[model samples]
Target: MRRATSLLCFLIVMLCGTVAMAASPVNADGYYKGIKLCGRVKVVEHFADIKVKVVDSFPDLRVKVVSSFPDDVGEWQFVEYGEDFTVQFVESFPDIKIKYVNSFPGVE
Candidate 1:
């Protein structure tokens, strides 16, 4: 009985660790300075990523990096790393979706 109980506890711990590792590292409600470009992503200017200036209202448009892109949503194109953009935190899934463009939108 003692051996069986010990084995069950060890298995439970291992299972929990696996589940935690499988989840994304991005916080659902925290500001993010950069994201790993798992898929294509639009590279914006440094200031553009800041949450205060970018997010106009509540429920800001921040996002976390997922292992795979969503089938229903669009994908980003440009390649940018580090704090090139700042993202406002959001309280939902599918944080942000964008399509690649040849030029910046609304710029002449």
Candidate 2:
């Protein structure tokens, strides 16, 4: 019975570890890796916080580029510096996929 208990403990530990290591694309509260989706965003060549791919349709988020007051999900203003987050555009292997929308922008 002691050996059986030990085996059960090991299985439980392994299961917990796997679950903890699982990665989600975004947080349940509409944040990506603890960074809020709204605000000034900067495009960078390298060492970006997020790698993004622009899609014509079926995107993970619908982004609307605004001039100011990016206070909601998927509302971003392009800026040269002092950005809330930086993104690198890539054709493949993106952290998140987005679509440019004129209206009603948010996480999809």
Candidate 3:
């Protein structure tokens, strides 16, 4: 019974660690589930490809709005149509939390 309890505890710890790592979208390629983090973005009220929350601190991504050439990670160009991806702003339960920055845009 003691050995079984130890094994169960170890499994729980490993599962918790996995959950923490899976929460962050930051990666070497800056892509989340094959969606590039940069490019033309469209803001929508509903049915968005990505849901983002604006936060003052501890942002998952630092986003920069650009006129053109949103090639870098977290650089986004607002578009009316033909957007690379669509996003919805929400007060809670965002898919990714973002901080708007003038420069140095990227995943944190």
Identify the candidate with maximal TM-score: 3
Candidate-wise lDDT, in order: 0.38, 0.87, 0.89
What tens-digit string does per-residue lDDT give for candidate 1 at 35-75? 43234443443334432222323222332333344211212
Candidate 3 minimal-lDDT segment of 10 residues: 20-29
Full-model lDDT, candidate 2 = 0.87
Quick one: ranking by lDDT, best first? 3, 2, 1
Off by over 4 Å in 1: 25-34, 37-83, 91-108
Q: Answer with 2 or 3, whichever has the higher lDDT.
A: 3
The C-alpha local distance difference test score for the whole of candidate 3 amounts to 0.89
What TM-score do all the candidates reach, one by one? 0.33, 0.75, 0.77
Candidate 3: stretches off by over 4 Å = 1-22
Listed per candidate, the RMSD to the true structure in angstroms reads: 13.9, 7.5, 4.9
Task: Kindly list the per-residue Cα lDDT of model 3 for residues 1-108, writing each as its tens digit.
Answer: 999999999999999978866678666567777898999999999999889999999787899999999999999999999899999999988888899999899987
Model 1 C-alpha RMSD vs. true structure (Å) is: 13.9
Across 51-102, the per-residue lDDT of candidate 2 in tens digits comes to 9999997677789999999999989999999999999999999998889999
Which window of ten consecutive residues has the lowest lDDT sum in model 2? 20-29
